[model samples]
Target: MDRRGHGVARHRDLSRTHYRNGVALSHETGSHETGSHETGSHDTSPQALTSVLAASAAGARAFARTTSEERSGMLHAIAAALDAHAEELVPLARAETHLPEPRLQGELKRTSFQARLIGDRLRQGLLADVRIDHADPGWPMGPRPDIRRTAVPLGPVLVFAAGNFPFAFSVAGGDSVSALAAGCPVVVKAHPGHPRLSRRTAEVVAAALREAGAPEGVFALIEGVASGVAAVQDPRVRAVAFTGSLRGGRHLFDLACARDEPIPFYGELGSTNPVVITPSAWRSRAEEVARGLAASFTLGSGQFCTKPGIVLVPDASALIAALPPVHSGPMLTPGLTDGFRKSLDELSGTPGVEVALVGEPLEEGVPAPVVLRTTAATVLAAPRVLELECFGPSTLLVEYAREDEVYEVVGALRGQLTATVQAGPDDDELALALVPLLAEHAGRVLWNDWPTGVTVSDAQQHGGPYPASTAPATTSVGTAAVARFLRPVAFQNLPDAALPAELRDGASGPRLVDGHLKTPS
Candidate 1:
C-alpha cells in the first residue's frame, strides 16, 4: 500500500517499520506505550536493539566505501523529500509541538537547507579536509616521509533528538544528516515531545535514502528511554550526538564513557547566554536595547539553547522603564512547563533578587515573560544562584555600578553557546576587554546583537565548553558538524594505487601540498 494520504494507510505506515530496533521487525511484535500523543508503537526490545546496532555497524563499512558523489546525492535526495512533504510535516509538527505555523514552516525550511548546504560542500571536497606532505630529501626537521591524511567515518552513531525545534533538531536534524554525510550510519533516538512527528519524519528519511541507493541501515529511528540507554552502552555504536538539558546530557555522557570501549559523546546540553551592555551603549539606545532583549528572551518561549538568560546593564531604573512588557504562550511540553515554573520560583525566592517586570501570573502550562533585578555584587557573591539557567521567557537583570563589575559577571559565567556585548563607538575599551573574556566561556561571541538566531554556515560554532557541549572544538551546526563523526588517518609512503583518490597524485580536491593550500580543477 502507498504510504501517502491521511487514512488507514497513514496509520499502517506508522507501524510498518520494525527497525524501531535498526532493522525492520515482524508485524507481530508487541506494542509499547509511546506517549500520550502517540499510541500503538512497540518499544524497541533489547534483542531488537542489538540487531539494529549490528546492522548499523555493518552499514557503516558499506557506506564508507561509497564515493563522495554518492553521499552527496543521498543528501540532495533527503532534502528534496523533506520539501515535498512539508504540507504534511508542518501541520503534524505544529499539532505535536504547539509551535506556530510560520515557525514550523521556517524551521522545516532551515532543516532542509542544512542538508543541501552539506551536499554542496561535500562535492566541493570541503568536508574531507585532505592534506598531503611529499617526501623531501632535505627538510627543516629532517627528511619528511610522504604522508597523505584524510578523514574517515567512525562507524555507527547514535543521535538524541532535541525537544524545542522538532524539525531542525529531531529525526532528520543536523546531527543525523551530518553523520550520514561523513559516511557513518545513524540511529536517532526520538524525542518524546514529538513522537508522532518523529515517526512520520523518519518514514520520509528512510524512503529517501532507499530511493537514493544508500546502503540499508544508513538511518533508523528508535523509541523509548531503554533503547537510548542500551544503544549508548552497546559496543557496536562508535559515537553519540545529543541535544538537551544538562542533567539528561550529563547522565548519558557518563553512560557512554562507562562503556567497555568508551566512545566519543558529543552533547549540546545547556547554556545561559549572557548579554552585556556597556554604560555608553545603554545611554545611547536604551529603548532599542530593551526591545531587542524582550524579543530575544521570549523567542520560542525562551526555550532556545542560546537564549540570553542573563543581561547586565548600568542603570536598572532607566533600562527597566524603557523595556516593553512581553507575554509568552504555552511551552512545548508539560514537563518543560513544570521545570520552568520550578526554576522561576527558586530565582524569585532568592534574597537579593527583586521583580522588575511580571506581566501575568503563570497558569498551569502557560508561561509569561518575567524580568528580575539584582546587584552585580549579589551575583558575584552567589554565582551558584544568580548565574544559572531558567529555561523560560525570563531574564535576570544584573545592575552593574561600574565597567569593572561587567567583567566580573562575565568571568563567572559557565560554558555558553553564545555571549553578546552591546556597545557603542565610545565604549571601545569595554568592548575590547569583554570580547576576549567572553571568548573564553562561549563558543560564539557577538557584538551589539542578540544570540537568538543562529545562522547555518561553515563558520558557525554551535557547541561550547563543558555544559554547552561535550566537544568544544567541534560544532553541532553548519558544515563543520560532520567533523564530529570523522577521524583523521594518515597513509605513509603508500603507492598511488593504494592511496585514496583524494590523496593520490594529480588528485582533485582542496588540500595542502608541501604546506601550501591547493584547490584542484
Candidate 2:
C-alpha cells in the first residue's frame, strides 16, 4: 500500500514510531531483525516478542486502511522482488530443508505465483464482497433502511510457519500471502527446523514490502516455541494460520480458544488422505494405480500434510503384487524423524497390520518408505492406529472383500484434506454415491488422480475438519484463503457519503450487489 496518499502518511508515521520502538528494542537485546536468533530460540527476554507483536498490531491498522488497488500493486512488487532474489533464497532453502534444488526452485516460483494470483484477485476487487441494499419506503416489515455490507480485515494474524516446503509454506508463504491480501499484518513464528533460512527469507520479504510502500511492522518474524504460544495468546493477535502435525496444530488451536477474547485459528493439520479404488480401476490399470500411490506417498519423503496415508481396495493382492519399489530418504528434522519412527513402530506393531512393502531405512534417523496391510474388519476394530498420520514415507493398505466393507472402512475414516476415488467410466452410479460420502469426510474429493501436489487456484481447498484442520469452513490455500482474515461489517442507514467507498450506491466497481455478483456495482 502507498504510504504517501490520503492520510496514509499520518498512519505510516504512527506505524513508523511503533516500528522504530521494536527496532530499538531488537538492537538493544542483540536480536536478529525480528527477534529470531541463530539457534531459532528466544535470544532475549519476553519483552522482544511482546514488543514485536504490539508493533505488528499497530501496523495492521495502517494496512487495513489500504484499498484493493494499493495492496495489489504492493503484492505484485513483492512477487517480482522474490523472483529477482531467488538465487539467494532457493539455495538457502535447499541447504536448510534438505530439499532438492529443482523442487525448491519450483516451490519458490509457486510461492510468488500464489502471491501474484491473490494480488490479481485483489485488483479485480473480489475480496470486498460488498453488498448494498437500497432504502425502501413501504416495506412488508416496517420501513427497510439502507444497509451496506462489506468485509473488513480481521486485525493482525500470527502465522506459524511449517517445516516442510520451506519456500512454499515458510516465511513468505500462503499464510503470509493471504493475510497480507486481506490487509492484516503478519507476525510469522519461523519454523525451528529452518531457522537461518527463515530469517533470511524474512529479510527479503521485509525488504520487498518496505520497498513496495507497505507500512512499517506490516510483517515480522519470530522464533521459539514459547513465543509461538504467547503469540496465539496475545490479545492483539486476532487470528492464526498454521501447517503442522495434529499435536502442534491442536496445541495452537487450544491456546487460541483459551485466550481472554479468544480468536479464530485456521490450522492445516495432518491428514491420512485416504484413497479408494474400485475393482474395475484395479483390473484395468493395476500397475498404474500402484505406481501413482507409490509416488504420492514417497513424494518429499512423505512429509506433505496431504499425503495419502491409506488405500482401500477390493483386493489387496492385486495392488501388493503390482506395487513398485520405493526408497525412503532423510526427513526434515531430527525430532520429526523420531516421531515418524515412533508412529511407524506403533502401526507396524499393531496386531492385524502386516508390513506389505517396507522401504530401506538405512540410517538411525531416516526411515524407508513402508506400506502396511490389514483387513477391513481389523481396521474397524483398531481405527486409531490405522487412522493416525505417519509423518514419513509410509502408507496403509486396507483390503476389503465387498463394496459394503469398502464403505465401512471409508466411513470409519476422519476428515481429510483430500480423498481420491480410482473408479472407471462405467462406475458413474457408484461414483455418485461414494463421491458425496468422501466429500463429507474431506475438503476436496478427487477422481482418477493423486493428491500429492496441490494446485493454487480459485477452487482449491487445503483444509478439512478436526485432525485434518482446525477450521473446516476455511482453506489455507487459493483465493478463498483471504476470506479467513476478513469479517463482514453491515452499516445500516448510511448515506452514500457516509458509507465506505466500496459499499456506496452507484459506485462502479466489482463487488456483490443485493446478493448478486455484478461488475461495475
**Least accurate 10 contiguous residues by lDDT in model 2:** 1-10
Q: Mind giving the per-residue lDDT tens digits that candidate 1 earns over 361-417?
A: 335548778888998999999897635688878898889998889888887888889
Maximum-lDDT candidate:
1
Q: Give me the runs in candidate 2 sitting further than 4 Å from their true place.
A: 1-44, 360-365
| Candidate-wise lDDT, in order | 0.82, 0.78
Candidate 2 per-residue lDDT, tens place, 142-215, comes to 88887888889999998988777787788889999999999999888777567677777777788788888889
Cα displacement (Å) at residue 242, model 1: 0.5
- Score candidate 1 by TM-score against the native: 0.93
In model 2, the number of clashes is 0
